[model samples]
Target: WHWPTAWCHMFLAPLFAATGLLLRLLLRLLLDLHALFFLPHREAEGFKEQGNAFYIKKDYEEAFNYYTKAIDMCPKNASYYGNRAATLMMLYRYREALEDAQQSVRLDNSFMKGHLREGKCHLSLGNAMAARRCFQKVLELEPDNGQAQQELKNAEAILEYERMAEIGFEKRDFRMVSFPFLRCVMRPLTAASFRQISAPLSGFLLSSPRSDILRMDSTNADALYVRGLCLYYEDCIDKAVQFFVQALRMAPDHDKARLACRNAKALKAKKEEGNKAFKEGSYEAAYELYSEALTIDPNNIKTNAKLYCNRATVGSKLKKLDQAIEDCSKAIKLDETYIKAYLRRAQCYMDTEQYEEAVRDYEKVYQTEKTKEHKHLLKNAQLELKKSKRKDYYKVLGVDKNATEEEIKKAYRKRALLHHPDRHSSATPEVQKEEEKKFKEVGEAFSVLSDPKKKSRYDSGQDLEDDGMNMGDFDANNIFKAFFGGPGGFSFEASGPGNFFFQFG
Candidate 1:
């Protein structure tokens, strides 16, 4: 059956093509089977389990190694990459963590934790905008995720803060003049007009508008003065002083620049002395130095604000709480966006038992920073405020929230003796009545706080008035007798409310 040459050639080509296709398919099957047998899924899973164990133990380095091994065995596994990303994040390797987190999300787009890790990496790297997007993606994946919600809020706050900071800077700088004429004419004229009319000029081509003017006309005294003002406001003291000096050199008769330069130098020196004294625990010296700095540069709002804040800190150390609060307020007035001043004022408020003011300041701080510590402080202030609205057992007894049972007992014993009605017998009727009221309050406080269930209920914000814990029903005299075995057991010498001496029989 010999066919024609052309037909035979056609048949052989088809047969060869089919055979090659079958061979390739068979080779791929063999490779897959080899992978299944040699690269055991169980082994990879074991490595992942080991990684998890190390992670639980907080041994991030060991966990990273095991996760890497697991990834090597199962390159397509999103979970392995996610786990490694978490380990890297614990090590503060945000860039590496970001890469792994991205890879994990690429492998499994639906992986919520992968997106969460990616968001956290973005946040740690200070890319709040990117972090916001990642957190939004996580919310899309898992709508009820609490961590994602909080992180999204944090990212939004940071972005808002940064936006406000930029606006503030623009407002302070003359470069952002919005008038069409000034925007178009004054800006270009300041930078390029001198260059065009005068000889070719050259200096450091800096990134600021004033710096541009300086680059064209380095000897321009007014531009130098303005540049120095920018640095001075930015809190770059030494650089600002240098620019001011340069301006004075360019025009010795420039009184404004001369005054600024002198004030900058004096302020810097005084601020340094204040800081040194503060670090050495000399609160009075620090206060004096900071005050001097404030006086040296009353016109320098930014620097004066910082000096006020520094003095506030010294005042706090000296237990001059009112002065500290006033100083913080002055700082806040000078720079409304001053976070440190707000925080300092909040602490002073807490120290002075102004719980409501403290809560407000802490809330502001939390809104800006949104850190765990800030949240904690805000919560504590709120709790104190709540307690203040009711009978503040801790405040009445002069005890802390974490006071031990023995400490509570000691505080109760001391308070009972001080507020005892008999102790104020020689005082006026108004004083006696006030002492009586305080005595009753002390008894009610002890009644609630001495009982574990009552204390817990009070601390958790439960209404104790409905829980058979009425102050009217509480007997101050009976409680005092029970605690101190009556006046016969303990003799007290008292001239007034604060002066009491007890001698136990």
Candidate 2:
């Protein structure tokens, strides 16, 4: 029985060893399959290493390319997809990055990074609604996403602007006509949000899919361009120009960068031209150039006000009193605190004999005046107003108050010949209208004063006292008969042989 047991043990021991080896091999095979199908560990590791190197060098395009390769190798890897989407966003390819981010979240719905990336992508694409959804998802997953909370707030603000625009349009408010659609759409993006989104998105959009191409890497060029634009808006023109030039050197085909450079140059040239004209005493020319500059950039407050003030000066010099007033009015409209416009307009009104208007303009200037020159201008305007108000109509017409009818007629005709609308046919429409009104008033004044009966009635206190008298009480026909004498007043009768008309009245 002992010998039989020993033989069984030897046979069973080999069988057991074989069984154990087989189980070990099966476990190894399953582990390898898991790594291969779900992770692609080796390929992903290689791509990740390459991506890290590129990212360190700020070469976002190359980084994005490697990250994308890593994602392709490990299709279910949320980290790889999230990283790649981040790189793409750097290139300004927000729409494409958004897809990748969405894919990452679809694969790994619990990944907070994926949701954050998706929200950022949506923000770049001006999809505030989608972005808010992703941000909300991030908050739900990680409740401590401060960045997401801020972004959501920004998106809400932009949405509000769009809503306001829609309301304005529905209400037919023409004042809101200049609101840009993109401005309304991206109202949520503050300067801080712009800096955050643009920096990454620029790199992603300009980068090539191939990781090895250095020339195709647009990270540096895009960064320079974005920084330049920010500087430009911040009023750092020289620094902005430098960045723009550097961006052009890095990427010559960059249209937006080139445009920024050109605009900066044009603005500088326009400013220089206007300054030159102003220095040379060509106020009108200076004003025109400044106006053109303002047209190019309506936000240029200095140029807008400068052009208006300069134009006012030119109008004043040209004796275009109304035009001077208008120019000053525009200046004040652009800058309500502009004391110069009020002073200039006051001067213009005084010149035009509009004493009441001049007084009002002077009072406004006095209230707002800060400089000594402004105060002096206000004082001068007040003095001029007093002088203009005291002007005698007879002195204006260059005739005595009791001038003969013939003298008044002669004076009126002479004045009308010089100040008639036809005489100023070459003037602007506004100027012509003003001159016409003035001439009409002058003619009417002359007509009333030249009429003996009307003049007598005007001189007496009776005409002023008769407040309830109608036009029928005047009896102008009787007045004319009394002035000319007889029924056929001043008739021409040919002295013939015999014509005796005897009236027994």
Candidate 3:
């Protein structure tokens, strides 16, 4: 805050330039010392010194040409081969680097740097076992080498990480974090250069399943702890820590989980406080606390749903139905079977006069649980569904509600010809089923409009004219069976297993 923003940027830029320049100079000086000490074939050594200078100057092509000249003059120098291998690796010519490294080791088996170079080449080629043996051999020669130890550890970790990464890839369709999946190390992460001659593959990666990393059940301490461990193994440390902390806070006596919890930054205190504010009707305060909790562990499905649903409830109280429905939908996506999401969405649908959508929502709830209350609510929904379906008979026939009998008759005949089952003999079974229903609807529309008494009743929403004097002895059940031919003719089981084609309109 003390320094101006413009000044801070200006200050950092030049400092970075100076630091880079200093590094380059230091490297050039070191390479010069190596060339001076290497006294075999003065002309060849001079050429290698030029190569080393060019290498430090970031001109790999020039360095490679000079190194090639040095190798031609003095084919017996292990250091020249090793230096060339290092340059080839920088240029991403890994197989060429491996050949140089092999020559270097062949020239001088005792040369530790030559072996190290070969090990790096093997590692780059994804030859982990070969790389391991090279590192092990270095250890046999020099038992106390720290770089060798760290390199060995990293090679093992690479193997483990790759195995785990593959497992994750198989389980889902996703790339990985860019760091090469940290920033690509000095030694590239991949075993070899990746190439493709086909079309350019390009697309945005979809959002990952964040909910899998989190836990929302405050009472289930053991469950939360177990879930955290699962996430930790999957390399999601940040989310894992959140669950672990919550689990430990709830079950303090759970010694093993508590130990793991100690390793994590906890979210239990804020969440509990948020829950308290919610119950006490301090919604704004609750919102603030939950917001902070979400910042720490946004992926916790249950926790996130609770936050969304709670906010939605407040929005609902304020008559902000649209906002409430949006939040509820978000919660549902996170946890598909979230009962509260279904209930809230159903209420929104009802408020908006989307009776068919409400019926569908209620059907989902009924499938999940069939409590007495749900049964009562479902019956009410069923009634509403029938009324809604039959509410627009005039519209189905493409006639106004106030249209005369002649107009109604003309509209019905037109729609009948367009949607008749025989006209759509080559249509899909589902389409045919819909057409048959529409034909029945059109006939009913004509029946209502033809008679003043029934038309008055239909317009008032006082009747659903399933049966009327349209066609003589027109069996509705026969029409239903013609499409869905089964033992139960037109069985209106809303949630039946064999009800795939049932639109329930």
> lDDT of each prediction vs. the true structure?
0.79, 0.66, 0.66
lDDT tens per residue, model 2, 77-105 = 88888888888776655667778888889
Off by over 4 Å in 1: 1-211, 249-255, 394-443, 459-462, 465-505
Q: Top model by lDDT, which number?
A: 1
Which residue pairs overlap in candidate 3's backbone? 179-182, 179-183
Query: Per-residue lDDT for 1-505 in model 3, tens only?
Result: 7568789788998999999999999999998886765554788989999999999998988999999999988899999999999999887667789899889989998878777878878877667668788888778888898888877766666665455444444555223321122212223343231100000100111133453223233466755665564454333557778777787778878775665554334455676777798789887777677667655544244556666776677667657788878888877865678888888888887776677878887888989998888777666766666667644776777876578777876786577656666555567999999988777776656666667877776665565335443344465334334434543543222245422222222
Q: For candidate 2, give the lDDT.
A: 0.66
lDDT at 8, model 1? 80
Error of 1 at 91 (Å): 55
The TM-score of candidate 2 is: 0.37
**TM per candidate:** 0.49, 0.37, 0.31
Q: Against the true structure, candidate 3 has what lDDT? A: 0.66
Q: 159 in model 1: Cα distance from truth in Å?
A: 33
Local accuracy of candidate 1 as per-residue lDDT tens digits, 1-505: 4567778888888999999999999999998997896667778899999999999999999999999999988899999999999999877556789999999999999999999999888876667789899999999989999999988987776565455444534455323211221112122121112122111111111344465455555897866776676566556889989888999999999887887788788889989999999999988888898887876745466777888998999899899999999999989976789999999999999999999999999999989999999999999999878877876788899999999988988999888877888788888999999999998888888888888999899988878887766668767878877788765677767656667677777
